[model samples]
Target chain A: MKRSNRLVVLTDFFLENPRKHIQLPYFVTICETTKSSISEDLDIINEVFQNQGMGYLQRSTGAGGGVKYIPAFSRENSMQFIEELRKKLEDPARILPGGYLYMSDLLGDPRTVREIGRVFASAFSKVKIDVIVTVATKGIPLAYAVASFLNVPVVIARRDPKVTEGSSVSINYVSGSSRKIQTMVLPKRSLEEGANVCIIDDFMKAGGTITGMINLLAEFDARVQAIGVLAEADDEEEERVINNYTSLVKITNVDIRHNKIEIQSGNYVENHTDS
Target chain B: MKRSNRLVVLTDFFLENPRKHIQLPYFVTICETTKSSISEDLDIINEVFQNQGMGYLQRSTGAGGGVKYIPAFSRENSMQFIEELRKKLEDPARILPGGYLYMSDLLGDPRTVREIGRVFASAFSKVKIDVIVTVATKGIPLAYAVASFLNVPVVIARRDPKVTEGSSVSINYVSGSSRKIQTMVLPKRSLEEGANVCIIDDFMKAGGTITGMINLLAEFDARVQAIGVLAEADDEEEERVINNYTSLVKITNVDIRHNKIEIQSGNYVENHTDS
Candidate 1:
């Protein structure tokens, strides 16, 4: 294979199988190269990244060890990237029933999830975001991705309170989709009073959950520094409650029955300049 | 400061604040250098990592864009690193009250958590692990870390079933630390029948949760290809129920009262030949 093709194959392997604990023989097998050749490829790839002023590749020298990436990339750049991503999301296929916008795939992809987190982290680099608040399930990974980058704790605001969560403060907010009341809660002490809070969610249609999160933060006497959403549906009817929040992507409409999707950039990533 | 020192400070910032979206100006501010100087440092550092086959450093050319590390380090190396980590745990200080091991710090650390995930992902590179399994809270991140690397979904086994999860498959097992009967459950269809499985946790004391996961996998007729842990306390008890696991660090013992901690190489890492 040509050198470029070989590099592509290596990158494909790296992205597909993200193990840093395999033995050298295994990598040699995967790359269909000798141990020494694999090492040389690694060296070249590592060199390419290092020369770029990005994060370095790490190697474990012991049993079942191999290589891993320590990204040295800028989070600020990620925010700008999100702006581009937001523009792409202008398609209309993401809207769901009940004013909900689907964003599971975005949260599931490591690259995209990391980008979203990086953008938020960059946006709040100078500010204090003591906690990341999101409703359960779809929002968990986004919360995790952001929390992971921020090195702070993430408090999941569940629609249904669990006894396991101990004592929690809850708020009844209108569900944007159904216009029905839904309750969201957080541990009473999850955030401190006057804490600077950043709220995140996977999608926003009516922003009910986001509003609930805003209320929960207020219950703790916390201030909302910013709110971020992966995608926001841009239908005029859905805007009944959205105010002063940022969305990375905007979906104009979706036809699940017809399998159509539309999305674009939301105002947040577009308006927010790189720091 | 010298270039090397400057790089260290910059790298440390990335490590310290994983949550912040990074930018050139931020680097310039921290290093007290010109944006151009910081850019040069970033290039040098990025080059070093790339040359070493460590990982890739990605750069975007725009006013708002800068550099960030997109780790593509090998999974094989991560698995080997975990083996080394396991060797470290054979020591005694890791043991804590009720035969538990303290590892909140490692679990909470972005670098360590990411590395730990890479370790398991490396181990299960060839295996088709449909779902990464773990108990609630602390294990959630580990499960996420491994899943992030493998590009697989993670399923958290709740100690008790809640309405949020809908229908779940419940199981009874002994606690790894307490060795008492406990119930854990997974949402129905969380693990497909006959799906390949890789179990992960923060610490393995009695291996009870691991055992429980094994049972839960069996309930779904899922195959548990291998098990991995962040740390394993060397229990005085005879015969561990599970085996073929990997860990990053080993706690031989811990004197929490005196605030003393001990760690060393784990067997998982030591067994590698470094090829």
Candidate 2:
């Protein structure tokens, strides 16, 4: 294959298989080129990736060493996306009857959801994650999106357990906004013992759901490496149960009668800018 | 930017934004090159993509003329993947007590799910799809995966409606295996009227759930362009509710006492091979 062809194919491979390491010889064989030429191709790809604020290729030396693509959204890009999301959320039509904002459309959008996933994945890029855990229904898409970029599997926690899943571990916790007790269950075999986990959800109210997930992870002896939500409600009346998490947007206020909604950029930008 | 860098960037863009049309002038501006050079670059990328069985670029001429990337998996690649999946599903360990198979792990794995999505998307590449619809819980990931490759949005149908989603249209249908009445709901605003939709799900037993989804789409006056499932049960006893659809694998047999399971490649290959 020619250099131009090799560059296109290699770039597609890296984007599709992020965080995966491959030996140099494999690329050389596929490209029908020498190791030195392949190395030069990697250099050019890495330079373009970094220059475009996409990410850089991390290369290691030695017998067992190779190259891995570390996907990261630049700080500028992350903030800009968050800001755009915040503005989109501020639309009056999003306000529901009970001061709830309708965000299912955004979550359902593949491009938007993938972009949100990219932001969260970029935010927690430094953290090691074995698998992504999320609750059923709404959180499933966001979880899978982040898992795709992180190159990990996703284990979903459901409100009801099915016979097909075999045995499971269930936990009951108070719903943050509803203040009603609900059950969350995960299949026993779904996660391995002592695995590192990253929790992802579509929305966060007072963090009770996330806390329940944390407690659920305890049963398997898994460590909570990180937690991320697409949006978080800024409720002054209710006490926040969970801290140390990343959110892309914060819902400040919602007035149903006036059809008004207020949204702002979440703490992801602030935390990531410093790093 | 140089030709090598342009190749990498263009490849990444096409892969990330499949099915999106881009004009030659846009590429020229981004690559800092002449239109002729950008045209040559696109031809190189398209040739490499087609040669690798990834996909090819479709170009048009005239006022609205542009290039669009149609991501596809060749029949050879699709059949190979389905065969591998069939063999994987034949494991006795995957059998549960009630002759059910445990497939959450496969559904949770991003790579596997994405590949499955690619097969389905490629199968329906000729069909025009405005949106992909799926029921809540298990099907969300597959729906999102397919939607990602098709460059379309996803709308989920849930068993129960949430306050944040506003008013919804609900339908009661009989379960295929359980033979019990159940409700399925989709938000009224989630989908537009007269949309070209593709339905996706993780598994199908007697196709009751899919039938319910099809009926529900009728209420919105939307057209069901295509349907795809990861797996389907080849039950001799029950009558299948759906006849027109694509599946990647078929669960042929299961014996709980013997801890044995049997699977085979689905009809996707036969239908696609002739085309």
Candidate 3:
């Protein structure tokens, strides 16, 4: 293959498998190329990934180690990817009765998940994220993937504490659906005081849990470096309780009768750029 | 290095970092040996993996392909790994006054988590597991890693319907705490009707949720081939609720007053086994 195409392939591999730790023997075997040849290819790809300021390819020495793509892409890429995703998400087929949208396929899609992880990773590229926090259930995967990329641990706040967790700090927040007091908890030492934390959730509705998480972070004197959600329901009448956060895509409107959903995004796109 | 030691080191490499697809360059880099030497090592290792009825390693042709380990270990191995895990859970120091075992460190331990995944992967090796189902949120990572090994997909069953998950199929059941109604959901079509599914969770309490899942699986006519939990609390009462199941560890008892927890595992030290 031509050198340019090879570089494209290499970069594409990194982009497709975001937050994945991979090694070189697999690469050489797959590529069926000499080590010198593969090394040359990686050298060029690494320079491009670094020069572009999007992400860099990192090589780990010794056994059980290989090349890992350290994604440094910015929020702009997030917006770009989401904009494209929004179009698909807006398809009438995705719209269901009761104003709900179908997103299981997207959530399960590895490629899409990778794209989502990269977006969050890019947004927090410069911030020293001590931990990624998310309320139980949906947000765990997103939190886990992004934390893995950032090489930080993930702390899951449970809707109901387990005896196994023992002596957890609890918070009561209203569920997005019932507006009833739902309790959540985290281990006492899960997050250090003054720790720089990033809060993420699969979806944002009224942002109530996000607020609770922020409060929890504050209780520990932890700073909220950034907040991100995979999708934000964009109904204005829902009544917002908090502000200043980044969402990969914003739902501008949803028409259950017509099976249509509209979305654009915030300036987090234009304001955020990767080289 | 001695041949036996070399095998151990190489096996560790394969276990530590697994991939669906790989390349030769990655292996050469990992082993830090000549291409031929590494190839020979892989030949032996591949045979070892295959002979043990574990996953097979397939080498792909072309410039970007390499060897891929198709996970095919048995559910029997999962039973064994979890048995050892139960030993850790039984440590009295892990108990709380409230009769709960402390598993935060076990949950946080990556090495343990990886091993859990490999053993879990052994189960359902034959089934085409399209989606791994688990009630959130601790089950999230176990589901993710197991899915990665199986090279399939995973879906988290939320305690309740979220704004993002459209039109969820909700099932009400008792949670671990035995408190109020705990609702979980599997989005419609997330698991195709009649699809063979494998369920995994971090812990089993009353087994209410597991039974609820079995009920939900009935709704879709999906088959639940096996159920695996990281730990099975061994209280005589709880033990009655669990049968025909496998666990990493069995928590015999928790003496919260003495901060003593007793554990026994059936995983690592199985009788009459040779690699």
Tens digits of per-residue lDDT for model 2 on A91-126?
Answer: 898877788888998989999989988888898888
Please, what are the lDDT tens digits per residue for candidate 3 over residues B1-275? Answer: 32333343445345434555667787666545666766666677676566545666677777796776666554456555665676666666665646866676665543455467667666555556666788776777777767666666776777767665566687787654564677777877577888778788888766877888888778888888767787766445544454656566666666666667767663323421322
Evaluation by TM-score, superior candidate among 2 and 3? 2
Encode model 3's per-residue lDDT on A136-239: one tens digit a residue: 77677777667655766778888777665667788788766457887878887577878888898877878888888887777788899888888887545578
**Per-residue C-alpha lDDT of model 1 across residues A1-275, encoded as one tens digit per residue:** 33333454454344333223346687666556778877766676666545544434578786667786544345355555765675554444544454344343344455567667766665565566776777775666677677665666666677766443346788999877667888887766455678877788877787777887887778888888878887777646766476887777677666666666666667765656644
Query: Candidate 2 — which residues are off by over 4 angstroms?
Result: none
- Clashes per prediction? 105, 0, 42
Local distance difference test values of all predictions, in order? 0.63, 0.91, 0.68
The Cα error of candidate 1 at residue A48, in Å, is 12
The segments of candidate 3 whose C-alpha lies over 4 angstroms from its true place after superposition are A1-54, A57-69, A73-84, A172-183, A238-241, A265-268, B1-56, B59-93, B108-115, B161-185, B238-242, B267-275
Q: Any runs in candidate 1 off by more than 4 Å, and if so which?
A: A1-102, A148-153, A158-175, A178-190, A234-242, B1-112, B118-138, B148-197, B201-223, B230-275
Which candidate would rank higher by lDDT, 1 or 3?
Answer: 3
Model 2, chain B only, scores a TM-score of: 0.98
What tens digits encode model 1's per-residue C-alpha lDDT throughout B94-170?
44444445343344445566777766565565566676777775676777777776666777777766443446789
Which candidate should be chosen as best, given lDDT against the real structure? 2
User: What RMSD, rounded to one decimal, does every model reach?
Assistant: 13.6, 1.1, 8.7
